[model samples]
Target: MSRIGKKPVELPSGVEATVSGQTIEVKGPKGTRSFKATDDVTFSVENNAITVTPRGKSKRARQQWGMSRSMVENLVTGVTTGFKKELEINGVGYRATMQGDKVLKLALGYSHDVNFEVPEGVTVTAPKQTEIIVEGIDQQLVGQVAANIREWRAPEPYKGKGIKYKGEYIFRKEGKKK
Candidate 1:
């Protein structure tokens, strides 16, 4: 038996969930999100909890069972507390700021400033010149936006200068001897 699949996802106060056919929708104070499960797995809402069960004793069914449960849990969490990702910029003259309501301007030692257009359902803000915060109801979108920003200037091993996630560690390398 799958340990994660066997556990039911509990709905906290102020959160609501509804099931329709192969789809499940969750509504909370923050927002509403929905997910569609595959035929290999079945989902149900009962007693303020959501449960995922496999349709048959097959490998695919078992795999979908656990994954479906996790998706439902994420939906509940997304609509309730939401998700956030923080990025730290390190380098000389490296900075970030908001160009407009939906654009982020970054200066990472490049010839010209780079403008990143923020997509819908996600918000990017720079509280400090070297710090960036990405917030949204969808966890995947928030993480993807953070990764895209970091890709522009990943931390280097020599000086560890560039953009990185807050609390992320960069292994340092020694320079060549003169």
Candidate 2:
């Protein structure tokens, strides 16, 4: 038996969930999110809780059973408290600034500033010159946005000069002997 699958997801106050066909939708004060399960697993809603059960004892069904339940739980969390990702910039003259809520201007020791356009359903903010915060209801989207920004200048082991996720550790390499 799958431990995660056996546990039902409880809907907190001010939250509602509905299961239709193979899809489950959760609505809360933040927003509404949904997840579609595979045929191997089935979803049911009862008594303010969502349950995911495997169609059969097959390996695939058991796998989907646990994954589908986690997905539904993520949907509930996404629509309630939302998700966030923080990025830190390190290097001489590297900085970030938010131009309203639409654009994020970045200077990573480049000749020209990088103008990152904010996508729909996500908000990017720069609380400090070297700190950036990405917020959104969708966890995947928020993480993707933060990754894309970090890609512009990934931290280098030599000098650690680049953008990286907050609290990320970069292994430093010793310089060549003179």
Candidate 3:
């Protein structure tokens, strides 16, 4: 009865999927990814699509069946098209630039500039010195890299100066009176 679980995942062209024991491997033009299925879940590939089913009628088995299937679908899509996160720097003098391999230099009104290294499989791009783009095949890694970069200069409540996701809302707080 899982809405998402009932939908079969379509396999894209040039992507290969193989199931061995409890492991599922998906390979595509971008890269290869693998995931381990839970004991109570079952999976099969047919007609260029992947389907998942729960092995029992228990609630826990049903819950894990949908979750595991969604995760596997995400992995397949990620390896093929990849994922991306965009961030913007607000406030005067706050900027970012690529320093070197796996390194990003940020200037955010701090005494010392912040340096962050891009993790493997993730790419960071600063197109306008104030706008950043993070891309990768793994959704978790992309989000984590964006969070780490944002932590260097979190948006302030009063001035809203710092790194933030594009289109994200920031609530401004009133400043103290002089």
Candidate 4:
């Protein structure tokens, strides 16, 4: 028995979960999310809780069982409480701002400014000139957007001039002496 798979997901208030065939849909005040289970994975909701079970003993089946369960649980939680990712800009003259219509324009000490268009269902906010916050109900989409933004200018090991997670740690490397 899988420890994580055995644990039941508790349904929060104002959240409704439904299971149909291999698909599970969760609706909440924030939004609605759905996940499709694999062939060997099954899920059911009982007493405001959700459970996952595997249909076969194969390795793939076991893997899918756990993955599907976790995905469904994340979907439920995301819709209820949502998810957030924070990014910070480093280096002199490096900053970020939200442009019109889900577009984020960034200045990372480059020759030209970079423009990143945010995906639907994801909200991007800039509290300060260098701090960025991304929120959404979909975990996958949230993460992908964060990654894409981070990719614009990953922190360098020498000066660390770029974009990075708010609290992420980056090991500094020694610069070569001229």
**Model 3: CA > 4 A from native:** none
Per-model lDDT = 0.95, 0.92, 0.91, 0.89
Q: Tell me the TM-score of each prediction against the true structure.
A: 0.98, 0.96, 0.96, 0.96
Q: Model 2 residue 17 lDDT?
A: 91
lDDT tens digits, residue span 88-140, model 2 = 99999999999988999999988999999999999899989999999988989
lDDT, candidate 2, residue 164?
Answer: 92
**Model 4 stretches with alpha carbons more than 4 Å out:** none
- TM-score: which candidate is best? 1
**Residue-wise lDDT of candidate 4 within 58-176, one digit each (tens)?**
98888887777789889987988899999999989999988876889899877999999888899998879899999999988899999999998999999888999989999999978
Model 4 is weakest, by summed lDDT over 10 consecutive residues, at 1-10
Using alpha carbons, what is the TM-score of model 1?
0.98
Count residue pairs with overlapping backbones in model 1.
Answer: 0
Order candidates by lDDT, high to low: 1, 2, 3, 4
Clashes of each: 0, 0, 0, 0
